[model samples]
Target: MRVLLVGAGGREHALAWKIAQSPLCEHLWIVPGNPGTATLGTNVDLAADDAAGIVGLATREQIDLVVVGPEAPLVEGLGEVCEAVDLAMFGPSSEAAQLEGSKAFAKMIMLEAGVPTAAAHTFDDPAAAIAFVEADQQAWVVKADGLAAGKGVIVPDDGNVAATISAIHELAATNAGTRLVLEEKLTGPEVSLLALCDGERAIPLIAAQDHKRIGDNDTGGNTGGMGSYAPAPILPYAEAQALVDVIFTPVLRTMAARQIPYRGVLYAGLMLTPNGVKVIEFNARFGDPETQALLPLLKSDLLELLHKVATSNLADVTIEWHDGAAVCVVLSAAGYPAKPRTGDVITGLDRLPSDVLSFQAGTATNAQGQLVTAGGRVLGITAVAPTLREARDKAYAATELVEFAGKYQRSDIAARGLAE
Candidate 1:
């Protein structure tokens, strides 16, 4: 099949690499794709946000399948557009995407479906939101109702809800975010659980833990994701299954009953509290740094799994995961989650380990035709091994092969596993 993947991020790069390994994927292409995809297939000169441009390319290219990588396009109804043209697409329709597109909407759905989740309130006006936050004594979570590239949610430990309101205003000033969802922050370790919702069934993927903070100890502003590892040692297998059966299944069934068939990956970022697993947030697409880690541990043919979901027979298919552990460490440009300098010369990428794969997130070729860092969270060095320790070590070893001016990474990618 000829597949067209959208977006230019680390997640997309990992997907491209996986697709290349599948016998089902005869041809592949990417639109507004990154420098990494250029080596695999044709990279069309169109932005991921340009819905019309994507449709035009699909029509011209006669794309057999369209896999959306980022949430922005999915929230904008990329899948719906493809459906109109009879194009087999992977990702949720805009209506189904509301689970991730609007935080308030997701909370309401979970409430209606009796799914385990945090209590949340929605407010359109800034003043009202601030007032609620000021009076709330518990730790709080503030979120923009719409998408902000995984950086819209704020978990405040001191209950400073006003900062969330202020941040929304600041983002709105720059044409970013509005209507807010204020949630009572649940206490516990966070886990990113992703599964394929094939309109009627939930096909589980590997469980992962994403390190959102830019610094080593998880301190510092969130920037998509810095690093991640699969089969989180902390959240054991039995505990993860309970969350899926008690939480994810109920939510997917509710969507089916509502007549909005969810047909893509549903990433439920959960807080495993003493009480139970509570939803932190919902993501319409695959997690970036998490994807980098999970893909390497996927033993099954990805194309076959995706095809089953798109065709909607996921009830019978079993998605298999490798017994080994996988880890991914992100290399970032200086000053991430804020203003970042780009176009720095990168080196040593050619020496990447045979067992490890380096995925380019935001990268470009310089005038001299060398791949250069073009985004804050640039390259994802992913590797797999029998144990989490081996995976972490392999990822770090691969990280050493890559370099550029102002390049920095966490010395500890899977440090959380050490707590055990």
Candidate 2:
């Protein structure tokens, strides 16, 4: 089977790596893929959002399946376009993708599905939002209604309603739409659980925990993802299955009832609080650093699994995972999550051990033909081992081998998992 994977990020690189390993995959291609993905397959020059260009390539190449890695294209109706051509694409339709595209829509669905989540209120008027925050007199998470990468939501520090108000103003002024959703801040260790769906059935993947903050010890602002560890100790396989029954099942059933059945990956950002497991957010596609870590531990044929999901036959195949654990540490450029500095020459990748995998995100080839940083979150260094401690240590050791100007990383990645 010939497959065309979309997007240019560490997630796409990991997907390319896993897909290339499948014996069923006859050929592989990535659109606007990074320098790392080039080693795994042919990197096409077309943009991921160019629906017409992607369709033309798929038709011309007679691609067997289309696997999307990012959420932007999925939210832009790429899956619908693929359906128009009878092309098998693994992703949710535009309507179903509202689960990620619009926070207000997700909140509404959660409310209707009886899924446990934070109490929230949507406001279109900034004044009304500020009034609500002031009246509540408690810490609130201010989120932009539309997509803002992974940094859309802002959590005020320690019940500082002033900060919350400022965040509301900031999001209202900067975001394209002034709409906002203010949610009651819930405290707990977060978990990332992804499920593969076929518009009817859902299969849960290994649970992962992502470090969203840019600084160590959960300080500083949020980023796309700093690092992650798979099979989170908090939620084992049996526990994760129970979470699926409580979270993914109702959500999928609700989506199907809406006549926009969800296909592809349904990523639930969960908060394991004292009250219970509550959802933090929903992503239409795979998580970045989480994918970098989780895919390395998957023992099943990724191509077959994705094809089954795209063709609405997910129940035909069973999922399998390695007993070992995996960890990913992201190397970010200077001033990341604000104003990242790029164009710095990178070196020392060839010195890494064969056991470690380096999936590139923000990278490019300069005139000197040297790899350089091109985005905030640069490379994801992943390592798999028999234990989470070993995996975390191995991943951090690999991080020391790579060198680039203004390169930084969280020193305490997977610390919570190790504590568990």
Candidate 3:
């Protein structure tokens, strides 16, 4: 077992390349990992929110499983400091990561677990959120009730209500003590759906589709993700099991009746609207370039489904996939998401193509070593096929054998599931 995997990006290098191809992950580690998870193992310079140097490096390296690939060290409590040293952590629990560290406490637990979302208002006074975005005449969505990584959500185009009230005073001048959820802009297509919880049964995975702007028909701004794809040929598997029965089983039965039982990787930033799957945020973990386009279409055994959701046994696991597509394609660096321009060097990551993999995410190396460009949605190529236009043509032909000095990507990644 011996896993560790906290974070460094490209969804922790695609969960350290599918947990080093599991056979029960004999050994693997990564904390401040990068350089594509230092080739799938020991990266450990420690600091995925350092909670006492990650429980003293998982009790001095005997770590049987930690796996918290981001969401600012599980919203800063680092899974209650690795379950207070009984350690075998995975993610949730800083009070179930406030369902992704507070979007007005996940719209007040999706309005007390009825679940379908959107139609909000939280504020914390930037002049009462610019007087409710100047008496909203629609097109709102201003977000930033905490975490601003996925560019803190904005959405202000059609008749730009004065740039959504000047982006709610520029995210209230850089989140001076956060608060401001304001929804009402929910229209169509957006689906991430992670799941895999053990807080008391939850499974759904495979339904990706991220493409968070940054140019190419969807237009600019919004980084963290620049491409993605998976079973989302427009959210099907019976509409992803009706978004796991109206959103992950009433938010895992209201976090197991509020004893705060949500364990890990919930995700679900859906929005299939026409009045159907309406949530647009909630990411307790796993969702970068949609976990590198759903872990190469995960055919199961991602370290035995995350050690059965960190030992809760995940109510009889049955997580399998790999039928058709997968596609990743992120690359970016040229001043991405405003001000990104790291070390540079990079180049054709060993000329990819054995079904293209990459991963990295803002790499590093230099000092005469090479492989540069450190952060700003840096690497990620992924491919996997069977269709979806041959995994978006082998992920844009391994994004043209990589490169650097201002790279950038998105030549229509999975072009609307290859034009349906």
Candidate 4:
């Protein structure tokens, strides 16, 4: 079957790798794909959100299936257009994508479904938000209602409360009318649990931990993702299953009960606290750096799984993962998440260890074809091995070999997971 995959990040690259492994797949095409995806199939010069163009390509190429890798296109109603054209799309419609597009909508769904989550209030006025924060619920999390490339959520330190509040106000001012969701910060270790949903059933994937902080020891501002590792050591077998029970099932059921009947990946970001696992947020597709880690561990044919899910035959499908550890270390251009520097020549990639796999996030070849620094989170160095220690070793070793002007990465990725 011919497939059209969307997005241009490490997540899309990982998805392409998995999909390409399927024996049933005859051809693959990635729209606005990155350098990594160029390995799988023909890369098309099409924007993920250009719905009409995508539909036109699907029609022109007679692509059998459309798999969307990012949330933006889904939020923009790509699935709706695909359905209109009778195209089998592996993404939710815009209405269904409200699960991730609008935090307020997701909270309402959880409230109606009795799903566990942190206490939060949706705000439109800047003064009102400041007053609420000053009133003090101890500690709080301020989030931009719309997608801010994962940097929307702010976790303020004791001395930086005023600055954090100012940042929140700045975001609100930039996107006025777009409300902000403020939550009384839930204390715990945050984890990412993703599932493949087919409206009626959802099959869980390996659990992962994403280190969002730019600095070591989980301090500093957030970027898209600093690093990630899968099958979180902190959550034991029983604990992991319990998390699914509390966070995934109810939420999926709620989406279905509302008649949305969600399809494609359902990502639940959870805060595993003393009480239990409380949902931090949800994504309608695979988490970026988490995908970098989880995809390598998947033993099942990704194409088969996605096809069955879109066709609503998930009862016959099972997601299998290798018994091991997979880790992804993100390499970013200097000054990421604020002012990123680009156009620097990259080096040392040829010297990377053979065992390590690199996932492209932000990159574009210069006129001379030298690998150049391009985006905030530039590339992902991923490695899988018999143990987390081994994987970490290989990843760091490969990272050492890869160098570019102003390249920066977190040295202590998966430290918490390893410590436990």
Candidate whose lDDT is highest: 2
Which wins on lDDT, candidate 2 or candidate 3?
A: 2
TM-score of decoy 3: 0.33
Q: Give the clashing pairs for model 1.
A: none
Instruction: State the displacement of the C-alpha of residue 294, model 1, in Å, after optimal TM-score superposition.
Output: 0.4
Q: Compared with the true structure, what per-residue lDDT tens digits does model 4 show for residues 296-366?
A: 99998889889887888898665677888998999999888689898888887778777788988888889
lDDT tens digits, residues 1-420, model 1? 888899898999999989888988878889888889887888999999888889888888888888899888888888888898898888999999999888788988899888878888888876777677567644456777887777776666565555655654654443335787777767888888888878877866767998988888888777788899988977776676666777778888888889888998999898879997787788889998999998988889987777777878787677777798988999999777697679899999879867788989978999998888898898999889999998888889888888888888888778887565
lDDT of 3 at 377: 83
List candidate 2 stretches off by more than 4 Å. none
Residues 1-420 of candidate 3: C-alpha lDDT, one tens digit per residue? 888888888888888988898788888988889877888788978778998897897899788888888887788787787777788887787878877777888889988998878888887887887776677655687888888888888889876888888888888777522778878887888878788888777888868788888999798677777888888878776667656777787888888898988877798788888987788789898888788888877888888778778787877677777788888888889888788899989888788867688888788898898888887888878888888888788778878878888897878887887676
Clashes of each: 0, 0, 2, 0
TM-score of each: 0.95, 0.98, 0.33, 0.96
Question: What is the descending lDDT order?
Answer: 2, 4, 1, 3
lDDT: the better of candidates 1 and 2: 2
TM-score of 4: 0.96
With candidate 4 superimposed using the best TM-score fit, by how many Å does residue 125's alpha carbon deviate from the native? 1.7
lDDT of 2 by residue, 320-419 (tens): 9988999999999998989999999999999999999999999999999999999999999999999999999999999999999999999999999989
Report residue 98 deviation for candidate 2 (angstroms).
Answer: 0.5
lDDT of 4: 0.85
